[model samples]
Target: MSNMHASKLFDVKDKVVLVTGGGRGIGEMIAEGYVSNGAKVYIASRDIKACEATAARLNKQGPGKCYAMAADLSKYEDIVKLIDELSKKEQALNVLVNNSGANWGAPLDEYPDAAFSKVMNLNVNKVFTVTQKALPLLRNAQKKDGVARVINIGSVNGVDPPALETYAYSASKAALHHLSRVLASRLGPEGITVNTLACGPFQSKMMAATLEKFEESIVGGLPLGRIGTPEDVSGVCLFLSSRAGAYTTGATIPVDGGSLVKAKL
Candidate 1:
């Protein structure tokens, strides 16, 4: 193909993308990026006001286009409703971004079982359930490329320990990574791609709260000598969902800026 056509490798024109937890932070950035690239973006979260506000602001910002839908991913009923509602609005579901998650940190000895369950419910169980519920929509929308795209938001902690106490969070992310690989294998013939975006620290609500408890030494520990940003996280998702990443599936692309390679002397 010509270079002009090649530039269209990452094109998402008219595609429909659903981004959970897209009301703010990393999810919001990904939603904006997709909208800029010509996709009809949908922002989903528990906070209806925040979702609507983000949609309005994004609509104000050329080619700005998106909608906001409120649905608690942690709830099965809500997931069904979301899938049903979106199915009615769009003919094909091109992308699904599982970004809604929660975390809690405490010394292992003091970690509460309730906290662990809560985090896992949202971080892991919800991811699996939402994807399962959305699978039909994805299947119905697969192109000749033989599938739709599913992006699971993972964490650097899923690969290595960072002295953090997010026990359930890390484990859940690890499971998500593994699950993505499994889905890729089983769903390949069905024409869908599944991948994980293992991300590094950024200006997220979870990171902001953790930063308050940590120190600058944390950033110093990263090989890149700086923390990651929302762009860093969203860029990988964009690539994976685009034609540029069509051949790639069952891969965990780490957007950690090489933080996982760091070592203590």
Candidate 2:
């Protein structure tokens, strides 16, 4: 395939994207990709200092500018405030990536109620709330190139439960995946696209901790030799949020390196 043809498949130039939990790890990588591609990127998270640091570093890069905001995704009021504040600065949000979430792992009998609630509040509730608050901006944004996109960060644990027990985290992510499908159906006609990225074992803070305790033998079970990377995860997000991804909605794309095909037995 020609370079131009491949380039035409995905382009986010001159667009505005808002990414939650974008100060570091997977979110930061995705933000960098968008900014490098000529799309103005806004990163939102609870850490004001981290946000500022990332914004400062990214602002020095070319093509697109980076902005940062401090917003706790677990709270509805905070999301409202975040949207209101962004509206004051930018015209509208062209893309929203709900990448902020917390996970808890415990055996079913040992899991506490707080584990479920805490993860759900940030992973699920916040997704719905933030999307609702950003609706006006998304609804009014120009769709000449493509409809506004909403990319929810999910987990492969939601699809196939590994022996490692992450009861609440897996359940929450599963619910989030389902929620994306539901929202996609309702928001499609409004020129908005919704989808979820079910990521597998990546070199993330969450994964590092899990890796220390888990058996290394499982590594050989993966079809891909190594675990996932920031590029592995962010590449998919960029595609789903760019013009090339306009036609994809109500979908759950995996960045798992064929791990989803592993034998359940």
Per-model TM-score versus the true fold: 0.94, 0.93
Clashes of each: 2, 0
The C-alpha local distance difference test score for the whole of candidate 2 amounts to 0.84
Q: Which tens-of-lDDT digit does each residue in 4-57 have in candidate 2?
A: 575766778888899999898778888888888888999999998998898888
Q: Against the correct fold, how does model 1 do in TM-score?
A: 0.94
* Position 52, candidate 1: lDDT: 90
Tens-digit lDDT track of model 1 for 8-85: 777777777899999998898888888777778898999989989889888877264789898988889999999899
Candidate 2 has its poorest 10 consecutive residues by lDDT at 138-147
Q: How close is candidate 2 to the true structure, as a TM-score?
A: 0.93
The regions of model 2 sitting more than 4 angstroms off are 1-4, 142-145
